[model samples]
Target: MIIPVDQLNPDTLNQVIREFLMRQGEDWGLAEGHLDDAIQQARDALVQGNLVLYWDENEESLTILSKEEVNQSGLG
Candidate 1:
C-alpha cells in the first residue's frame, strides 16, 4: 500500500523504516551496522524522490522502493 508523503508523521515513519531494515538485516545475514546504512540509503532515496514508502500488510512492515523500479521488479 503506497502512502502519500503528506500523510506520514516523519518521526513515526522513520521508526518504522528503521525497524524494517533491522528485520531485513536478520533475513539477509547482515551485521548490525549494515542495517543502519541501508536505512540511511533508503532515506536518501526518499529525499531524492527516487522512492516512496509503503506498508506491507503481509510483513506488517514498512518498505521503500522507486515507483518505476517497483513496477519492473514484479513485486508490487
Candidate 2:
C-alpha cells in the first residue's frame, strides 16, 4: 500500500529516509557529506509525488520508490 508523505510523523519519516539511504550506500551516488542534501531531495520527491512510500504487508517493511519505478514494477 502507498502511504502519503504527509501522513507520516516527521521524525519517523526522517529515520526511515536515513535507513533507506544507508542501505542504498553507493547505489544512490551520494557522498558521505551530502547525506542531508540527499535526504532533503528524497523528502521533496515524496511531497511532490515524484516518489512514493510503499508498505509490503508480507515483508512487513516500508520502502521508498519512485512513482515510475513502482508503476513499471507493477507494485502501484
Whole-model Cα lDDT of every candidate shown, in order: 0.69, 0.87
Instruction: Summing lDDT over every window of 10 consecutive residues in candidate 1, give the lowest-scoring window.
Output: 24-33
What's the lDDT of the predicted structure labeled candidate 1? Answer: 0.69
Clashing residue pairs for model 2? none
Off by over 4 Å in 2: 27-29
> What range of 10 consecutive residues in model 2 has the weakest lDDT sum?
24-33
| CA lDDT, candidate 2, residue 7 | 88
Best prediction by TM-score: 2
TM-score of 1: 0.55
Candidate 2, residue 15: lDDT: 88
Model 1 Cα lDDT, one tens digit per residue, 1-76: 7776557797876786687666666643357557666767767767776777767789997676677966886655
| Per-prediction TM-score | 0.55, 0.87
RMSD of 1: 4.0
| Backbone Cα, N, C clashes tallied per candidate | 0, 0
